[model samples]
Target: MEVSRIRYWLGVLLVFLAAFCFALKGVLIKLAYQYQIDALSLLTLRLLFALPFYIGIAVYQRKREPVAPLTLREWLWLFFLGITGYYLASYFNFIGLVYISASLERILLFTYPTFVLMMNAVSRKRGISRLQWGALALTYLGILIAFAPHIQFGNQHNVLLGAFWVILSGLVYAVYLVGSDSMIARVGSQRFTCYALIAATIPVFIHYLIRNGFALLNYPAPVYGLTTIMAVFVTVVPTFMIAEGIKRIGSANASLVASIGPVFTIVLASGLLGEKITALQLLGTAFVLAGVSLIGWKGKKM
Candidate 1:
């Protein structure tokens, strides 16, 4: 019992740290943008810096466990997931952040869980439960409320464009999550993540080469520094932390703990990026948290 208690608390701590680190992602991206680097270039640099770590993990895991080679079909699935989840989804998200405030970007991205539920319902050919319907309603309502201020005060067109891209990012990421379920069950999560990321790195580099061809590497030294931090701290570290946290506590509790991410992003944006925090945004955030929490609780019960 004592050991179990310690594990649970440690899981909570890992999840909290992961959430906090993820909250810094938007701010870091926003800061990197200040250096006038294009989204693709910054993304490429991040992946470049991150690639070695993931490769090392993959190699280490394979040697440690000595699993049989994956089938061709599994390789295809990994490629598909890597493209949709890491490459395209992240591309859209980085593009969206080019226009919107980090606070809004984080809030909008947080709605992906709703997309996951919707996709699950469709795929299963079952109607959403009343509780889930209410959860969905609350989630969209929160988005609208949070979005109103930007529409009123900011460049209406830019805000709309950014929100659209972010929403698309969320949708694609939801597809990735849904597809990953069976694959993760088959291949262990750590190996799956490492392999998927490795696959994703291929396309990222290809895209960078086609688009910029080394021309965009001429940025201030701080730009490289920021991307390195974003790669190691925000992207890679939190990922494994969340996975380990889930192993200890379970996905439901880890998700609940992760609800702190948007709130932390809001506070960080205010402090670092000078983004304002208004009552409506906070209210919207509360509603989103409640709705997502409802989903997590319902998912746990089911």
Candidate 2:
């Protein structure tokens, strides 16, 4: 019993760490750009470099626990989930990072819970209860509060684009989550993440060819270092951990726990980027939290 308890707590900790690393995605990417690597270049660097690590893990896992046949339909859906969620979403996010503060991007990316709810609606789930209703309301409100300070000062064009991309990214993530959840039932969580990364990388490489010819990829010492860290720490490790977390905990609980992601980003920005949390952002974050809280709190009621 104690062993199970310890494993559960360890999983929770790893998931939280995954969310924190993801929040740093923008920060590290922007820092890479300081040396002149563009979004296309950043994506290329991260995906290409991270590919070996992903493949290695996937290969190792497959050796231990062979995967059963996934029907043609499941394979198709997995491709869609990976391409849209990982490749397209990450590209959009990196583009947004070029224009916004990491803190703001983090706040926006955390909006995935709203999409998850909407996705559930698409499936005709039982129903959302009163507590969930209240939690959703607060979570959105918290999101608004958390980043109110930084949004106003940015260029209007950049701000609009930033909001657009980050929100889209969140939607893609929701789709990926729902799609991959089914796949996880067939394969173990670790295997799913391994396959997920490889599946996502297909379009990612294609994107590099059509959009960029690699001019943007050449980087100096600083950009190379930061992008490597971003790929390994932010992209590979944390992402795999989060996928496993989603499988261990239901998406509702996982999303709520993940909702706390922005708190770490805002606090980190204050120290490293010297960005201050604003009254409005704090309020938004509170709303987002409230909404997420309602989801779980409401779960207990029934």
Pick by lDDT: which candidate is best? 1
For candidate 1, lDDT tens digit of each residue in 169-270? 999999999999988888788888888888998999999989888775689999999999999999899989999999999999998999889999999999
lDDT of 2 by residue, 1-302 (tens): 89877767777877888888877777777677777667877887787778889899888987888878788888787778778777888888888877777777887887776677767756866576555566666666665555445465643346777778888888888778766767777887777777777888777777777877655445687777777888799888887788767666655566667767777887777777776667776677666666766665454444
Each model's Cα RMSD: 1.1, 2.6
lDDT of 1: 0.91
Q: 260, model 1: CA deviation in Å?
A: 1.0
Clashing pairs in 1: none
TM-score of 2: 0.88
Q: How accurate locally, in lDDT, is each candidate?
A: 0.91, 0.74
